[model samples]
Target: MSSKDYYPMETKGSPKSYSPHKNGNLMDKSSSEQTEKFLPVIEPGLDSLNKNPEDVDFIPVDHTPPDRYRLVFFIMVVHGIGILMPWNMLINAKQYFEEYKLGKNETEVVELKGKFMFYLGIFSQVPNFVMSGINTFCQCGGQASPRRIIISISIMIVVFITTVILAMVDSSDWSVEFFWITMMTAVILNMATGVYQNSTFGLAAILPMKYTNAIVLGTNFSGVFIAVINIICIISAPDPRTQAIYYFVCAIAVLLIAFDAYFLLPLTKFYQHHRAMVRRQQNTSGPSRSFQETCALFGQVLKKIWVQALCVWFIFFVTLTIFPGIWSNVTKKDFPIENKYWTAIFCFLSFNVFAFLGNIVSEWKKIPGPRFVWIPVLLRGLFIPFFLFCRFEVENKVRTFPILIDNDYVYIVGGVLLAFTSGYYSSLTMMYGPKLVEPEVAGIAGMIMAFCLVMGITTGVNFSLAVASMAIQ
Candidate 1:
């Protein structure tokens, strides 16, 4: 509901300053002094808000029709995929990068590449972290925030243009100048990636928890699809150059599909209905969050669900640090998989599929609520060192760690547990966090969650790069 629900609000201020249609258009507004009026701040608790079940425009997940549910799920997953596809390309194309782009020898290339790529990846996360961190303030309201939708579509345009440029470029002719230019393009692509990713999470926050889950699931799905493509291209292509070309072509195609899905999402009946209901509800009250008030709202949200907030950060941090960052470097030359970072792709696939499965399993089972959520999630830290040691790394100048768990099966098992816990627990936290307060503040909770999620990911990338840069050699 819009601030109108709190309508007939007896504010002490003389003027107010919020006006925007749900479609993301700007409306003429009075002077900013209107916000100076004394409005009662929001208190915690659904009872405090004086809102009823029917008052909320969107259907509750349990009551929603199966068809609409599926549609929401599909859009979330597709957008999720698009948001992280750039990361996927960077991770899976390690072989191409290691061979053509990096150091002279296998040892130097593998060790240094992980650190370099992680550094680059984290640079991209800055925008995602910054934009999502203050999403509630940036958004006008849950329904009428046209800025988020416009930002989402605009980023798509930039990313799409970048993809086309990449596809048309012939890297074989690249020099030092051209290579750095390519890197600059990557930076822009990743920066745009962060903007949309956070926008999506913010958008989903305004919807039900299931839609959020769907978007998170889409990220892992993107990873799996990218891994599969990596495997197929490696097997089918004549050389690394061909594989690189295939990667670019397929990236453009996948991005196009993701954009189409996002474009169609608003046209669906369920989306329109939900939006209209939110708009209608707000007619009773005008949007009234000011800069200071927005900050206070964020603080309120953080205080309520800090546990879930921390867990979400740790989950991604651990997962992000280990899987490809360290995995890309460690290779047993004598091992059966006689390829560079092939094991990394395998590990990537394993984690994505298992994580997706865990998200699905959450439909029926949610063990150890907030009480024990932190414990198991904390234990996941072991995965970083475990997955690290499992790979072939230099023990010293002359020798390497014994390849004890060289079998693919062992990595597969590790991936399953890691991913399952990551997906299930993370989903549970997000699904429950928003419900802790009034529905009006749910979007704020979601924005915070997205911030924490990206923060964890950004930190994880840093840890992987910093630590592995020292140890991998």
Candidate 2:
């Protein structure tokens, strides 16, 4: 049959047409003509095109959908909870150290135990750094499959379970070697889990940059929430049993994470499938870019913006490195209150509160400048000195209550400033890193930032130990 006879286009004032040889009847041309009428077309004027590209008519492309926002937020919350678990452990370092010292006879042994804990932090960071690097390589162009998501979630679950089991096993009165081994095992599990955790962070960074402010705010808030919950449990519970409760909560968190992973898997698979289809079409019709080429292009773009990226890495490294030592010293010596648990809670609360507030102020319209971003870092530098110099003396052991409660106003002011600085830096890191890197390589950039942070932590631990030892002598 003729092409025109098989598929006819109706026009105004056209008479009835027929393909009797095939259809056996003439078609109603008037009805078809009315049904296929074209509407008025609006064309952009030359002035409009010259004024702005936005004024020209074009199809809207939403790279990030609403569901992706929910996914990002949920992932942030889950990962925030996981990340904050270490904060509680760090806050309780003094108690853990004291317990370690109680069993050891020689000063050398005690020091060795302390060194082991420090090394544990360093070793744990190895997996973290590796994971960060891997995440940077894998995460790109919003491509993650549902099966991959499931596998990631399963790994996290297994890690959390392993951590809980180790914690439980270590709680019993056990040999020092066994205790250390179990603790190391837990650290290993945590470090391995670091791969998935850091991957999530990389993903979060690459997702819509506009949502970054919200993600930071959410992560900070969630971290605080986890810390507070940990504080309450540790304080109220009579003994080591509370650790079990912590594990149970963590298990629930893992389950929630698994559910989230399962839900996101389909969406990620859909995105990957769509990307493959587009890539295939391009390959057939035009020159197609390989993933390596895309990565190289991203590297070139980052090379041009290296200054901001390096600044972000350096600032975060400094902040993370210095803050841990400050926490260790402050929690060990300066806290006025007698209850160590209470002190830990107070420190965590203060730090998180300041961080959350810093994020809020950064978003404030009245601020109008990047000064708010620097406030936290500058405040942190100032606080370190105050923490070093300020001191409070305790006397009057005879009476039930002390005659006077000596307070270090300088230290308190410094602590507040430090907290504010931490908050500010946390917000800025999330904000500035994405700004420095292209969206496609945001994951890699975030991983690099995490590597810098881990290095800082490693150096900070050594510095703290050296300074503390020297002071003791």
Candidate 3:
């Protein structure tokens, strides 16, 4: 059949003819009745205006659909925020656990106080990392869908609801029991969140790269929200119980909103169109893969994007190593500012705000490019020592090493740089990972990067314990 026979035009009749592109766009046949229109849909690399472009196909320009109101982008951002909500809520309300629930007596304080934070870190990261690895391969084996995302969020909602109830009930009489119960909640919450987070990165990878960056922005924005809330709680001086209740309830509300946003994803033409393109690229009618096929694809994707994976891993490793664990303890009691406000404003608030801004900057400019992004990622190791040499209040141990960066202003500036680079390089490396591989397995590539990201956080959090120990005595 001729091209005209397959793609016939309207003959100035009742209504204009239209054909839907594979990407769900409508092509107007009346305008091109006499001649066919084609555009170069491939990247310019091999040959220009050649008879046959290398592994490229040309389609009408109308095949591309616009992201209406940027709804899909915004929804992905919301999911991004939801991904980190559980962890942020737990950490932001540290005082409620450390002081109110676990610090009923001197003995409790001496025994359970340090262990609470330590165990919290371990339980949260360990399950999260393991589940992320498990979920990554599971998704690669054709179980990738919004159902898992919804189910994971539902589990977290239930866990947070239980936490809210526990926060309201007084646990002072049974502080030790309360500590174990709280640890159980942390374990359950992180497991669900791990699946939720990896699925989000995988879904976003199939879309445009900016959508992936949007998730990074949302994650950082989650931190900014919690930090701001923390400052407000400090100023209002809410009781620990009251603050904990509000924090858990607010997290529930965010999850509910995200739950609603996800239902809207299928209705968005932009999302559906790109999703269809990914299917067509892979030459698959459905998400189906044998275990052996998934294993082979995983190997191929890892081979292509391993460098970017390392970059993402090292970036977060440096970040989690010094953050909250070390930086949160650095006190400025000698200055006029209250030690609480200093940590709130400089450490929590500044890091989050600058980090969010850094995510924004990364979207606009990708300096150093993907190939050399590792240079900056490695250089972030300096932050470990930079914060270490500052005035950190090591518990019950005198510092053998003198504080070199004693100036408060200098320390704050260093924190700003640290936070900004964490956000910027993180976005760059994550966005780069999926793009390095072919479209069919790009989602798998994103999952590998996410798994590595979790691995980085897990190792860094545990490593911070060592750094804290050696910093003084």
Query: Which of the two, 1 or 3, has more TM-score?
Result: 3
* Candidate 1 structure quality by residue, lDDT tens digits, 1-473: 46434433344543322233323322223343442211222222222343453443332222222435578679878888887887787667766665565534455444554355565666656655665555535665442243444455456556545655654565544434434554566566666666666667765765777888888878878888888888888778847666766776677677777767766766565554444334333443355645665565567668878988899999989987876666655554354665644565556677777887888887678777776788888888988867666664532322234445676567657767988888888788777776665444566677677778888887888788766655544
Whichever of 1 and 3 has more lDDT, that candidate is: 3
Q: Of the pair 1 and 2, which is ahead by lDDT?
A: 1
Question: Clashes per prediction?
Answer: 9, 2, 0
Task: Give per-residue lDDT, candidate 3, residue 304.
Answer: 80
Q: Residue by residue across 1-473, what tens digits does model 3's lDDT show?
A: 34443222333332222222223322222333232233323222212232332234444423556888999899988998898888888777777888688776667554667645556777788899998988988753332456778889999999999998898898878888888887888888889988888888988888888999999999999989988888788778668788788788889999998998877876666765565445433432223545665566577678889999999999888988887778877877356787657877888788889989999998889998878889988989999999899998755567768888888888888999999999999999999999986565678888898899999888888888788778767
TM-score of each: 0.77, 0.66, 0.85
Best by lDDT: 3
Q: Report the candidate with higher lDDT, 2 versus 3.
A: 3
Give residue 284's error in model 2 in angstroms: 11
Residue pairs with backbone overlap in model 1: 3-285, 4-284, 4-285, 4-286, 13-37, 15-34, 16-34, 22-144, 24-146
Write one digit per residue (lDDT tens) for candidate 2, span 219-298: 46755665666566666763544544474455557446545643453244323332222222222222333576546644
TM-score (C-alpha) between model 2 and the true structure: 0.66
